[model samples]
Target chain A: MGNVPAKESPPNSGGRSRSSTYSGSGGGPFGPNGSSSSARRNTTSSAYHQSGGFLNGIANANDKRSKKTEEKDRLHRKHLLGLIVRYTENVDGGYLAPFGTYKSNLDYNCDIVRGLIMKRRLAPFYTPLQDFDESWTNEELIVILNQLPLHSIETAYSNEEEEDDIDNHKIHKSTNFYRRQEQKAKLKELMLQMKQIQKEEENKYLEIKSSSSVGQRSVELSSNDLLLRLYRNATECPICFLYYPENMNISRCCLQPICTECFVQIKRLDAHPPHDEEHNSRTNNDSEDLPHTLISEPAHCPYCASSEFGVTYEPSLDICTGFGGIKPGKFRSVDESNDDAIASSSTSPSPVSPRKAVKPRRKSSLAINTPGVISIDMIRPDWEAKLASARNKLARKAATASAIHASNLIMNADEDSYSPSDSRRNVGSSALSNVEQRMIEEALRLSLLDEEERRAKERREERK
Target chain B: MAALPKRIIKETERLVSDPVPGITAIPSEENLRYFEVTIEGPSSSPYAEGEFKLELYLPDDYPMCAPKVRFLTRIYHPNIDKLGRICLDVLKDNWSPALQIRTVLLSIQALLGAPNPDDPLANDVAEDWKKDEKRAIEVAREWTAKYAVKS
Candidate 1:
């Protein structure tokens, strides 16, 4: 993922060798005058001279040269084989050809060769010679000896050409063999790379699809669970008059999902109350003579049967606690009335109890007997008022914040304009969002209005 | 299917345990990747007393990406369109792995409280907000009263 440093060679500094020849028409081995070839030859000869008397002079020199040439040929073949291996590896590693044009397999082989040579030049041994100029002379000689193999390799290839004519068919067969092997390796690598890329893409696609699917599944499961819990709680949908199923349309309120149809019905009933003309007339007539009752009753569930039958009162704990600490016989049901009387007798006060006790009991009875009042209509208006006030407060806060944000943006813009650096300009250019900029402008206008209003108020106060 | 990203799972759990006050969210039992949420309007905003529903779905690479959230309930805010789509940076380019459902919902609630007309999803709302904020706010309040309020 990081950049790899490129390798380069220093310029060669020796004169050209007149003996150097090129079969193909081109410039010198290292440009005009064959400077590189002469330099290399000199370096090798010096190295040979340094190893004096190690062999039988002239004859040994020729023999050594021939042997080295043969070795060079072998090494060249090995290098070619290595290049083939690397090409195949790169293909398998998912390297793709450049867009627009198709590169021949031979081109790939050439690239491998170039890469190897470039790497070799970057070796530590080829470090700059300026710091060790004195030793570099000798080092240069060794380098020349090291490069002698390149010359021999070229010579070996030429020698093979002369013999190639006699064994033309065999030579072709061998070349074909090498080509096939190289091609096979490259093909395998290409297949591997293709598979790897395909797999990666496939995985990415699956991830996106599965995530949404999982989310959907989770929603369904939770809905089902909610339905089950509601069923277990013994709550039924009023509209269907049936227990909730795993799948059904449900609207939630207070952690409960009611059927939408039932909810609509409840809303409708709560919004409108039917008036009974006879009951109203009777109540109007009694209102003048009867004492006003301060106590209000709790509202019963609208959907309950008792609500429709005019039998809405329920004997709740609040009723018991409020009235004289709940007298034993007082509010007993018909079935328990006899038992209640007996219990009352056991807990009855002594006959000798004073008038004070009787007074307190009467006060407590009045308090308890008077049920707490709840008016659906009254609660609704109070809630509406609260909601309105809250909305107003939020609007005020939003206006203030928006003003501050606008001022900050203006300040930033001013700063940006004053700054001269190109980097700062780049930063500002990127910061601007067309939509956001427009919104800010609107917010600024609002801020200005608020500011004007505040200023006007201040002026009036000062005058006062 | 690839396993859910660890960051997303952690964020989801956090959102569930310490949900935004007005927002009630629950992961689906059948699949832990999806969430159903109900958000109550903040008392101080024009949306007060309004209840809005939303759906959130996590992608496989959720933490590295972003959850897909869409309003199921109709709303009238500069950043929220009639189609229920929202235009917020956190849901787009500004998305960071650190953001969670709680933060997202909170951001959305904040957005309702103070719509960014500058980055609106609804062009008409933005134009009205720019030309006459009072009218824009009135429209928003009207929508809340008509469509969002539970009553």
Candidate 2:
């Protein structure tokens, strides 16, 4: 058979000369019978020489293949190194996003490394390649790399490109457009996430609020958290120094929120002293007459009471008392009884003027022994009269006791030096001791005779 | 978020952990760039026994720029005004990148010990110091005893 003869021809000498001729003239074209002719030449050549020719062809093809592979490996290494350097150095003058590039490059390198490991090719350079997971395949790594946006990689390259000439401006502009679009997409995604989180927080707050009692609701309403937030958001109403909600009667001209009391003042500026009859009549026909009537007078602000006023329109019912003469319930006249009491109390006393009644009480205590001494007479007259009567009795008793004690002491003195006549003379000395001794003795004898005659006459009349 | 200036973050960390003696700086947690500091007066000066508080703020470009330092605790130094604003060359014109928080604090302590009366922030205090050193020192000591002492 032809196959048997061809198989045996490899051991012949004819094939050696044909193979030599073919090598000497590189890649010559053969005729249609070339296969048969070549097989016949191949059979003539010895088996050793034929085997040598086959070895030479295999070696030549391997050399070309190895050279091409080495060139490709060098290029891949250069690219990988460039990526590492750019990411590590952040070579975009600090403006570029190295993180994105790093992630992408990491994914790409992982694929290449993973492919080499799976094929057992990495064993030569990385000895433990067999231990790595086979599931970490190249295709999986490539998917991860593709997931990273293209603009990010372009950004890495553009940073280097910026150092080049202005002639590259068109390319730079196009890259910037792509970068902006990528940034916008990223920003939108972030915003959506943030909104979701905010919504969750708000729902949580609502849940807490709903579970609470009315008392708790009031407590929550008045809590410092809410009050502080309101205060921060609300500028002080220029009129009252208190915060007015934005829904209140804010002055359009000044952009200031005014209290209802101040809002009245602002609305009445045009109506001061009453407008002309013609103008009043024309404006009075409006159905909202309550606001106009209440705002007729340019009233003083209860707070500052400044007469200077301006105009305000679009006053809300909650904030303004009189809007188109429709008086809100909050603006009714305040009760003046408490105010009157306060005014009276404040005006009643002056530090400079002494109180008349208080002065008398102090003076009477100081002048206790003098007439009008006890205005205790004024406070309690009966008690004062009884006290005075008791004092008179005390004085009489003191006089009698003092007189009796004096007589007892005098009586106890020496009897011989104290004659009865001498005592009598002493008692009568003031009236009769101016004359001589005989005249004093005759006067004493006559005064004794007259006293005895009077006594005898009174005794005879009593016996009859 | 705007990226934190790396230089400021690094320097601030160092300043907090390894602070200068007689100076204590504590930045607000809510506002990392604003700091409150307390400086103890140096010994051998009229201001001794004093502990003055200061407010410092790192601007956005800090490290590239110096921080703004003000005396919140009133001081009687010639270089500090009644409003508690301090006038120091290092804070304004003579700032250098090499200078850090520790160095600035030391400079402030030195300023208190040896005031620059010729270039004064509080003119009255400076005038008193120039006219009568003893009186100025007495007043400074009195202020220290009254206002700055811990007790």
Candidate 3:
């Protein structure tokens, strides 16, 4: 009787090789133009490439094969096919899942996932000294990893395909009839809009150039502007990493613009007496912002580590787009900003006077007095206020599901009874859970409402 | 997350444009947080004339927290252990958010110049240095030549 050889289970390395055959279908005969159908064709070609193994020879042998042997061989092939399918399905899931949060269809919290990570951790190469039960599971590692601000993994499958999209613009050069027309039209429209914006900007610039008292004064002004722009473009604040448009505070040690805002913050941190012992504590408490990294300071410069760097504010702060900004030398001294306003008022022929900024914060005019005294207020930074702001930011970022649930319950509270938001007024301690924070906020709201209602009742009695 | 804080990017850019003397730091292509660093020992120190390889990793909360740094090259120093871990104030409790990559590396270079045996990570080396300073220096110089020199 002719007997077929029994097939063994494929090991991991063999499984990997088998799964890679999925990509083999990508470069098939039918897809001259790349399409999903080409991948399907590739799969068929790959299957065709694998000619029947020793089984065919065994079947062709000039002896009648026992019915039981034939049945066993058929069942073995079907089982092997099922295993291959499972392996391929997993490979596909890994490639398709969004990076970080690899939320596949499979239940991550299930025992199967726990078993898998356990197996990985138990491997001989893994750390041998760790307390096994206390250590984080693979699921926890994945969750924390996903929480980290990082990008998706570049799977071999997807990365190769994205490169294809770049050349999807083949229609612009080749005028290929097969290429989608709507996409090309959208691209053309986008290009036209960009050109239009460029043209408008050029025209506006020309008008400004023409209107600026043509000839000698204009040339002088333009040269001044060029120098200012060069300086502004080259110099960026070392602390904030923003270009110096205004209020440049150059450190005496490094001579780099460290920005007044950052310096002020540094000064505030300096004022907070150093908490020496807390540095080593690994507690997950947010209130202390995970223990301050700094110890004692005549607070050193971050760049040079020099304690002697005195901050010198630039004379003409850069043109500040907002509060705490200064675009220097753009109008001469800080005082020139106001003068330019006056100059424009005198020369401009337009009927509509440009609305002057209301509640302007920085008066470049005030900056004329150099080496302003470092008042106690300036040197002794407000540590509490800074901490409050920092605490609020942490609370916002760390909001969990429970916190939202608590907030939702508070939503049921009568809006009429709700007083002004006390949540906005004060920052809670970092140790409070999101749920606790929401509850505190609701309580604060209720108390405020009570006060308002009492005041309203008093007014009604007086009117009666 | 929040795009690598602008301050970090600025620090990295300046590192490339105007590299520090006797030191070089290049960020890894895969992860910007990881840096492959090379520092030349100070001329005055026992580590002088030797090039040290170090791996520096900026954590997610860098600037707010101290960078994780480990020496790759073997050396004989009181403050540095066999595991390549360093015992320095600036890299630990004394760290400030104000400190950057340049400042931290400078602090490490300074640590090499002034090996404080009293506050040492390698206890055995520290004991040797305290007992016989001259003999300890000899061992350090030998190790520098043996392990640190490329040739």
Candidate 4:
């Protein structure tokens, strides 16, 4: 189901128009002129100055509020959550400790993960914690803060930045480099704002905690205990967009959360017949002489587009021994043996297998099997068949070419060496007699021409 | 024909609830996946003040596949062809699931603000754009007035 129901629009309409209006009062992160292209263009120069002033104003002016202030706070929290989401896009570890090896970036990544806890997408966060009390808990308010819509801000700020430069965009192609730098700086500023907001919420929570004695144990839990609980919390998988426990499968490249169901669905695109590009490019119009064996490219990470896409699943220790499954830091491709370990031990049967339930048509011709990784053959079930056919095509092309030339070169002996069976047998090995070697070389040359002809024919058919 | 994904529903809700400025996307009543959209041209561009209409349809594998978008209101531009097929990278190969309808529409709006004649989808328009940018922009403005202006 790719479509969103239009009927759902009306109910959420109450706070819909508040974004543009909110940006109006205290010049948005952009500025006084609001969304005019010129104001946005000037932002590129004094970016930090405007963001700092606007963010500080919102931070300081907390008490004397309007009804719009609540909505504005919601928008601010959502934007902060968005910054965290974007920050984690390239981070290398799981939810609790997302900063992988670069200890230098630990403080930076920690702030992002801390912000991630407030995401409504997280399983434990599904129910609004605010309904229980008028004076909401720190976490509850933080979650409420995370609930505003930033789709408009994202479009206005990021997309417009690119558009504004479309005239001289090429000259400023260093935009990506600058954007990364800007993100890091912006992330730093937002983290400080988050800390301030959390501090205020913490003050309120402390007052509530002091007044209430019954629920002391829950409120007084140590930060370490909270971390442990966070480890046990359910994370929403970015690919399948479903929630799962913290130990959900992690993509090898960017460590983005993915479920096992979606992990197995990742497969390589139709394996290019080996040397397809090189041979095609080498002899522009001639595809007849190239070899026809097909070797599949490894599937890439959907999040990062990192090739040879694979995932490592760490079992939650609380469920079982947790030591039974593949340990972290292992780069095993998702294979059958591991698949069983994963399937049998998955915390719960997935509510819906996204592959079977939603996207059954995304199957590719090749599975993810590469040599040396004895992992799950989840996608590349027919790799052997594909390789065999490629061998068959090579043998046939060799035999036909040898048959054409062998009789002219060395009568009976070469004809025997060039025989279909001999060519077929020798296609798999390199050891050959002098005359047979020459015949095969000649055959290979002719085979390249044959491959070119076949491809050209296919191209013509494709065009038609 | 399948039930709508939650992602689409959420995206739809936000697209309406917190709509992008100068851009409005309303899902069709008949088919939840189909949306009627209008992007007001950027203020400084040839398409300024023009409310260009576009039809957006999410295929079975949206976010995996890009939403199928085409211009409904015609105007002169280099990157948009006569059939309303837009020649933008994000609309085709560069699409990521992270991108949403708002981003795509914003991109279209941006494309209008800055048409790259070098990468022309409408060859004759692009040629004219390169030969005489002033005249080409004038024609774009004329087309905007003639066809894209909403009654």
lDDT of each: 0.39, 0.40, 0.44, 0.47
Off by over 4 Å in 1: A1-464
**Model 2 misplacement above 4 A:** A1-464, B1-3
User: Which segments of model 3 are wrong by more than 4 Å?
Assistant: A1-234, A250-256, A264-464, B13-17, B93-100, B149-151
Docking class of 2: incorrect
Q: Give the number of the best model, judged by TM-score.
A: 4
Candidate 3 chain A weakest lDDT stretch, 10 residues: A121-130
What is each candidate's DockQ, to 2 decimals?
0.03, 0.03, 0.16, 0.02
Error of 1 at B35 (Å): 1.5
Q: Write the per-residue lDDT of candidate 4 for residues B39-77, one digit (tens) a residue.
A: 999999989989998878765456555777878788799
Q: What is the TM-score of chain B alone in each candidate?
A: 0.87, 0.92, 0.96, 0.98
- Candidate 4, TM-score of its B chain: 0.98
Ranking by lDDT: 4, 3, 2, 1
Model 4 ranges with Cα > 4 A deviation: A1-232, A269-300, A306-308, A321-464
TM-score against native, each model: 0.27, 0.27, 0.37, 0.41
For candidate 4, the iRMS in Å is 14.3
lDDT of 2 by residue, A1-464 (tens): 11211121121223223223222221223321245444643422322242344436435556544554455445544434422212111110110111221122221232332232222221101000101122433333223322322123322222111111111212112122343455445444543443344345335444544454343542221222212111212333343233322223322223333433223222221221123222224342332232223223332222233332222223122212211222221232132442343335443321221111222111111222333211111211123223333333233323333333344344444333456666755644522222223233332333344334334534443543
